[model samples]
Target: MKEKMLSFHDVKHIYHTVRGEVTATENLTFTVEKGEFVALIGPSGCGKSTLLSLAAGLLTPSEGEVSRRGSIGYMLQRDELFPWRTIEKNIRLPLEVQHRLDSESLERARTLAEKYGLGEFLQSYPSQLSGGMRQRAALIRTLAFDPDVLLLDEPFSALDYQTRLLVTQDVAKIIRSEGKTALLVTHDISEAISLASRVVVLTKRPARVAAEHELCFDGENDPLRRRENKQFSEWFELLWKELNA
Candidate 1:
């Protein structure tokens, strides 16, 4: 069996606003095994992003446990790259923040950039890159620190349809190639099915695990190819009903 990389055990989170208290999750339990790609999907304001925050250790659960075995990298909805910084500099931000910007780490970042087709654009600022390219750079930045797991919060939502498709494939490929486990929170069903090995559906506010489908596709595991599979539409229909339930 695969070792567990991250797990949420009967977790609950309540936001104590001045207005009152609001519970976002209740009895939420799930696990992302090492090297597994899992996507969490639900209705708007259903606490999907809150789950990512919990996994990333950015927020403490009000009850139960959120356990992680290693470090985490987060990819936000936007590229979130600094306009003034070059691609190289942006990718190096994590290391800089951690005060580990040594020559070896810098070289690792450079190698990742080159491996992902961003070598020529290392000196280029974020504004010079296309949307898809910028997202790729953002992913490389997240991977630069070699985090054991990646938390993606609708990383492709900001792109146009065309760009989103291309970048989704790119990000999926990069994550697989690097053998990194990922937990993605996306509202797009097709996007979730395309990139994840498992699709986890959550209920509305006070989110709980509604259902989970383990995906298996013949031939290539590429996101684009997965979309073309005969099973894709069937899976989509099933998930659609679950999401609406």
Candidate 2:
């Protein structure tokens, strides 16, 4: 088994609002092993993002603990690529900000972009790229920092269905090839089942763990193949029932 990388111990998150305190996540507890791909799925407003925020260290838990032993790279629903920066510049931004940019790292970044089919667009600006390409750039930027844990919040939501599928396949291949640990917050049941080794389902607002499943399939971890698997729809329906229950 992989070593534990991120852990939430009875975590509780609350928001202060004009009306009063609002609980977002309550009594959540889980652990993600290093290099493990875990997915968070639930009904809308189920605190999936709130759980991700705590895991990313963007927010602190009001009670209990959310802890990570390594650096985190966050990819939001929006690509959020800077218009002023070229693809190369954007990918290098993380390293630059962390003061880790050097000739060797630049070379590594260039290689990553090239290997991922972004080489030809290295000098292109965000506006010059397609939505899919921009999302790739966003992911490249996240990877340039060499983060051990990637927190993805609906990274493909903005794309159309076809684009979303293609991007999901690409992103899954990229993450697996890089051997990075990922915790994704998504509402798509098929997506979670396809991309994750484990799925953690949560209850509606003031979320708690509702269910967890470990996926065991017979072939390459490709989204397309997973979708075609005989067990795929079964798992999806099961999750749907849990979410709607």
Give the distance in Å from residue 181's predicted Cα in candidate 2 to where it truly belongs. 0.5
TM-score of 2: 0.98
Estimated TM-score for each candidate: 0.98, 0.98
Which residue pairs in candidate 2 have backbone atoms (N, alpha carbon, C) closer than 3 angstroms, thus clashing?
Answer: none
- Give the Cα lDDT of each candidate: 0.94, 0.92
Q: What lDDT is reached at residue 36 by model 2?
A: 86
lDDT by residue (tens digit), candidate 2, 138-200: 999999878999999999999999989999999999999999999999999999999999999
**lDDT agreement of model 2 with the native:** 0.92
RMSD of 2: 1.0
lDDT of 1 by residue, 15-124 (tens): 99899999999999999999899999999999888899999999999999999998999999999999999999999999999898999999999999999999999999
Ten contiguous residues with the weakest lDDT in model 1: 212-221
